[model samples]
Target: MAREGQESPLLKVEGLAISHGDVPITLPLEIVVERGETIAIVGESGSGKSLTARAIVGILPPGINAKGAVTLDGVPLMRLAERELRTIRGSRVSMLMQDPFTMLNPLMRSGDHIDEMLRDRPEFASRAVRADEVKRRLAEVGIVDEDVARRMPFQLSGGMCQRVALAAALARDPELLIADEPSTALDVTTQAEIIKLLRRIQRERNMAVILITHNLRLAFSTCQRIYVLYAGSMLEVGDAAAVERQPFHPYTLGLLLSEPPVDIRVPRLVAIRGSVPRAADVIDSCGFADRCEWAKQICRAGKPSLAARDASRFTACIRQDEIQGELDALRSATLSATPETPRRGGTAGALVHVDALVKTFAGRRGRPICAIRDVSLHIMAGESVGLVGESGSGKTTIGRCLVGLETPTDGDIRINGIAAADFGAMAKADRDRVRRTIQMIFQDPYSTLNPKHSVGQALREALGASAGAPSPAPQERIASLLAEVGLSAAYATRRPASLSGGERQRVAIARALAVKPAILVCDEPVSALDVSVQAQVLNLFRRLQVEHELSYLFITHDLAVVRQIAERIYVLYLGEIVEEGPTERVISNPQHPYTRRLIESIVRSAIQRAP
Candidate 1:
């Protein structure tokens, strides 16, 4: 069937707004999608992008009031009853939720998920036909093995779980698909594979897709049009090409420029200065005015109306015409922030060393699963080492074993010339000394922090574990620690639930530094943050390393971040070290095929992008 004329869009949203208990979650917004079009809704975290999506699909949480007009193929979604809306979900529209581990049921096998989705379909009522269709759908998403269908979500890797989620979504056979942060936790190569798979399926089925992600690169490269939102309001909407080349909204421009350019000349990154405002603040005036460099008094007084400049572009800035000059000047200036720091305490000998390390787990039927196999690496004092690999390659397991969370099955780990085995068996004083010497900054900050404790209490507890006489007043030291992490003393009283992801991570770092550790094992610290926040945290790491003379064992799946932070690189594959060398040499001329493919996969992900 041919697409309808532009007179009728496949999915149309007009004046959509959401509120919870008199607080605005999203301002009045408008969106339109033609048949077979893939549109991107891009913004930073807490910008209301996901809230808008939830409202569109009628899945908003309790107490949240959704006021909008949503139409799909001339059917009024907002007007539908609960029973009516539920019927249209899988057959008419399907949503591929973010974080498959949470979205999917852990108790059920992967095959059961597909079966549940297909159960509603008329063609697969028979058991044998449904079983065969399950395998077929899984193969379409790149999971070709039938054995994978029997495994529960907890048994599969992050990338494999994502493919299973995609396969389940496809089984619904909907006319429209909403992929919410589909590639968020995935590594670059795995992310690329998922993106490619989605695009291919979209084209093959000629289905309209709504891609909800904070990644600007994905917005520019994968979608036909982009809608930029800030604090619940639509700031800009335009064709991806025009918007990427010359964005009218200041927030949009800032988001694009915040990404570190691959060019050597642009060594520093200019981060957006402020974070998103509170829900109450967003309801009164322009939510981004305080953060935008070009804001005027009028901008904060009242909200700016979205005005169309042409048939294909719209912007909400009242002074959109004046923003270009400011942006141009910002582009030409050398970055104001120092993104890199010189090696602070580089020593002749290694600070932490591993020799023939191995970690194995007992699998089903008592089979041994080797997570780490004879991996040996070292980091010098004040030097940063990158441990890069796909999921299940043991990058995190190494960090755990080095930190003594896991006992090494074989080989040795030496921290400051003390063997891990000896350290574990040492006297109480010696163990305390080792704990102070080496500490870990976990990947998820909230999980590491206690919900019952305030930030001040957390810091104070670190001080209480003192290796010396207590300071005169712990409050002064707590304030100092907060300041060192770029947070104010006010943050000390705030609990973990009140802080943002970036703020929580900073607190995690401050707590680690409170013990004055000689070395920090940072495990994907910035992976959970937004792009702008990620830059800020990375810059903070460099500055702290210089100030405290610290060494870091940085484990991450993002090769780009590893390239920026690590001096040396180790590429792991299937629990074995496949490649190891200086960061530059390893990235440019990788020796192993796995390393080379990892590099190429990232490059190929940008198959289409705005110049």
Candidate 2:
């Protein structure tokens, strides 16, 4: 326990409930954070992690009702008026959102956003002083150049934009800092740097931080205490290390088992079965009972309150003892298994092949930046090949080059024995045919689907523009496409704004499939989605590929996703392919130093519980 001081226990919450349009999305929740302490809220998507944070900040979306006691130094946030809440927003508690691009004003320069946060501060009254402070903050977050700070949000990379946002949020030095999946949008290296920066900031300022995320490893690595939420209810809470070492709840145990082990190669991931229950569903029983292997009749009868499983750990599951034993046996078995090398085997026929691929871009001072260098690989006609790397490792660039968005400076790209250069030199009609064979599904579905158009309209435009010859009626095809992506035909009339994050992604996938392409370029497709939704999407991708014989060039930074679908894996580093082998082998053995580092980092994260 942390020692109490005048400014200790910066924030505390009790029985927080949030509803959307009369539907309760989250159940009663509770959390606490002391000055200079980090509290991590961990759960799968739809687990109500983000909603809990929003409730604390008094920023629940329209039509959402929040009932709770949120206190900051004994001041009741729920009782405060909107006008009063605004004054405390940045000055007392500030938030760094998941996507910096969305949080920032696109029309304004990066420096301006930081300056705006510090506008009322007496020390920043002078323009020159403000500029210097902004630059210093930028530099502290790994952006070393003044020119980079002057650019607009759109002009900067995702990592750079996030750094600028962090600088802006820290400008006020608020008493409480709420970081909602701050590193989700960044690459692995950038994610590490951001975590380190947050730790330093917390230590230096003694600010209470509410870190909300689905990544258990990240939470264990950085937070002092861990609060596991499921269906908007607190499932468990304990010291980070203690809870991870001996997870008391079945949900927490499932989450721990689901994560790929560090030292040994497990045959298959132990995924929790079933999807997260919808917001409209009744929360009468344990939220995790449906998917729990050890669930008993009592678990389904009624919701369970958090009960002490030991001196320090509290769990809400009725079968915690039984599940704990099972989890222990599984962990021991996993740790004892001998690591095996990964092998590749799949469908026949080569769909795409790259030989000595190289891409270079001009840097700020006329220096050359090697984006992809001497990369070689092959993807079968009906296989899903994963490309994994930290940020700036050329994963996105490779995807871009394959989709013809960027012409590679040097390399031979062959699609079905036809060279890309030869295809580029062919007639327009021939080029169009080749282009239709491959399509890309972007990371953010909302951005990919135009807000102005309905789902039906978007599909129609993509089909009409990309498909060579239209044989079927547009309406029928649109309906079929929606059904194929697990959406109802009635959704055709709705715009992207009306859909959930998962629904919008399904629409994006449907739009990509409108042309019936042979291959799909999925770039971080599930990174932005909730875990349960991610599972559904992954299953959908697999089903689609098997049913349609579709090939995939899957690019992502997440190794767990790669292990799920990818048979062969290519590990990139600073635009170079450092390792290439079967997914299991690369992850377990990890021949390359960078790959080893990544694995070690993940292991270290898992072992080091919060605080």
- TM-scores, one per candidate: 0.94, 0.81
Model 2, position 580, has a per-residue lDDT of 88
The C-alpha lDDT values of all candidates are: 0.83, 0.81
- Looking at model 1, residue 578 earns an lDDT score of 91
Question: What tens digits encode model 2's per-residue C-alpha lDDT throughout 230-346?
Answer: 877888988898887877777776676665444444445556666677645747888777787787888889889888766667888777776678877766665555544334435
For candidate 1, which ten residues in a row score worst on lDDT? 602-611
Local lDDT at 599 for model 1: 74
lDDT of 1 by residue, 1-611 (tens): 11235568889898898998888788778898888999999988998888888888899989998897999999999999999999888788888887888767999999999999888667888988999999999989988889999999998988899999988877878889999999988887888888889999999999999999887877777899999988888889888888877778888877776664432213555578769886568676778888888888989888788888877889988888877777755654533333343343475788788999988899889999999999999989888888998877899999988888888889888888777744567678767877888999998999999999999999999998868765658899999999999999999999999999999999999999988998999999998888888878887887888788889999987776787777788999989999998777787778899988787666321312222
Model 2 regions more than 4 Å off: 1-8, 261-265, 330-343, 346-350, 356-375, 380-384, 391-393, 403-410, 422-441, 445-520, 532-552, 573-611
Candidate 1 vs. true structure, TM-score = 0.94
